[model samples]
Target: MKRSTCDICHFSIKTCVCSYVVSPKLNNKTRIIVLQHPSEVSVTKNTVRLLTLQLTSVEVYVGEKPSDFTVAQQIAKTHHCGLLYPDQNAIAVESMVSNSQTIDTLFVLDGTWKKANKIAMLNPWLNHLKKITFSALPENKYAIRKAEQSYSLSTLEACAYFLECYEKLSAEPLHHLLTGMIHEQTKFMPEDVKKRYFHEDD
Candidate 1:
């Protein structure tokens, strides 16, 4: 039998987190686009799915390359778009924070580190855009996901941090919502799942 999906959050009934989905007012000119891998769409723990539900203006596209996502490619071409990838050539988000240039759009990769790398490598158009990356951040509270580094943050966390520091917006609301999500998801995750991905050492 097919699982029932929540109309609001578009998550399976057993996994729907509509309760924690708050309507955040993201009235800004900068557009946030999430380029997700198709494989991530069905993952119960995917944060980008939950994130798009809360933030009204955010857009999500599924594909490994920009050519496969027409709108994302068009936006990259037409708008002053930037890629939120930490390639060696990427400029620190901190430096862009004070720059006079206005970024009308931002493209973020939504997948695991390896998966995200694959997306970046496949999308050659992305290399031409302004490569943007963040400084080291605090430990993530995404209890179900492990970080390769102490500064590794979940997709939503990175979006929130970027908005707070670069857009002069408050990340408190997003943080509050995500904290509740982690708490709920953690309660249901199997011990083995927790051990492998949420290892304290990671």
Candidate 2:
């Protein structure tokens, strides 16, 4: 397999995007943690890791075993933990807080529906987390994943949207830019799936 370089920064994975991607400016002391599936680490097109790129407070960790919980556990020590999952019966993301207090540990699982389910199930600690169900009014603008709507967003997209929604700010442009990155990655997909993913709702 060949590697793709960032057109703007010209950085490769081991040295470039991973080392110097800029993070998003944040307020109110919110922290984001992306528990990426180990399989996603090598996919040059995966956008999940980009959360840490735009958000200085965000961290990314990948693995199969929950025993690799040191980093997450450390963060959970100080911040109340909330897992981002879509289940209508689940509590709203906003309700995770009380009395104007901000949550410190927010776990956003990044993967396909099947992979995410396996990861969540494999990690018992994740299941114990306070689940957050997001019902955002905004539609998902991520062109890469090409879902029916914004109702279901990728990991990075969800993080960006959550920040925008809770902070009352516009993150749409940034989300579109992330979609551009996805466009670069399309070459790696099978031709038919690539066409389907890109032209789904058009």
Candidate 3:
């Protein structure tokens, strides 16, 4: 049977994280545009929903094709757009900020590396934007989920960090919310299984 889910956070009611949802949305000038793969929309561990809920300037489009992103494309054309993808010529976020390069809109791909690569390949126009990347990433805090890369961060964490550095805001609220959600999720896990997947120190 399908579990009843919360209309807000979208988690199963028993595991709903609405309590951790930020009350006043975090304000920022850089508009976040998340190009989410359709497969990620229903995944329990995906963080894009939380990101959208807490940030005032966020747009999420769920699809893998160019046609699905026409609005995003238009926005990109009109704004000082930058893609949060680490390409060979990508500029570090700090460097861009230091140099006073304005990024009115940031495009973030929400998917695994393979899936993100596919999105990049399908949308050739994305390559035309200035690529932005992080130089030093903090430790991953989403302990309930596993990432293929050591440097990988959940969508929420990435956005939070980007906004922290770019907008000079604290990411603590989002980080705290994520920690609470992880704690809530671990409550239902079998002791042995939970031990294998998560550690207190992490």
Candidate 4:
């Protein structure tokens, strides 16, 4: 039987996160563009959906190749855009913030490390954009999902961090919502599993 899903958040009725989703009041003009992997569309753990719901200037495009992102490319060409990927030559986001350099749009790739790298490789045009990365990341709070790197953050977390630095605003609300979602998802897990991932004994 198909589970009844929330038309908004798309999570199953029992796991709907609509209540925790709030549109954060951003004071900056930076727009967000997410290039999501097709395989992640239906995954409950994916955080791009939360971003679309919370940010007014966010767009999400689903694809893996250059052909699939023509519209996004056009938009990027017309704006001071940057790709948020941690590459050797990527500039730290803090450097841009400190220098008062602002981008009109920011492109974020949504997928696992390998899958995101695949998307970047398939879309060679991404190489032409200014690449930005965080110099230091906060501890990962996404306990329900396992990432290849210990410092990996959920898409929502990374975006919040970027916005915090770029806009110089508090990301507490976004972090709060993320914590709620993680709590909701982990509530159904076995105690041992929760302990292993979240280090919660109770």
True-vs-predicted CA distance for residue 182, candidate 1, Å: 1.8
RMSD of 4: 2.0
TM-score of each predicted structure versus truth: 0.86, 0.73, 0.95, 0.92
Candidate 1 regions off by >4 Å?
148-150, 189-202
Candidate number that wins on TM-score, 1 or 2: 1
lDDT of 2 by residue, 95-126 (tens): 44433554556788777777778778888777
lDDT of 2 at 54: 57
60-149 in candidate 3: lDDT tens per residue? 998899999999999989989999998888888766572365778999999987888899999998988999999989778787788879
Write one digit per residue (lDDT tens) for candidate 1, span 1-202: 8879889777677766778766655564568899998888888777887667667679999988657788888888888888888878887776665256558788899888888889988888888888888865655878666666666788998888777767777777677778776766666768887676565775
- CA lDDT scores, all candidates in order: 0.78, 0.64, 0.86, 0.84
Taking all chains together, the TM-score of candidate 4 against the true structure is 0.92
lDDT of 2 at 171: 59
In model 4, which regions exceed 4 Å deviation?
23-28, 98-101
Model 3: how far residue 159 lies from native, Å: 0.7
Cα deviation at 181, candidate 4, in Å, is 1.1
Best by lDDT: 3
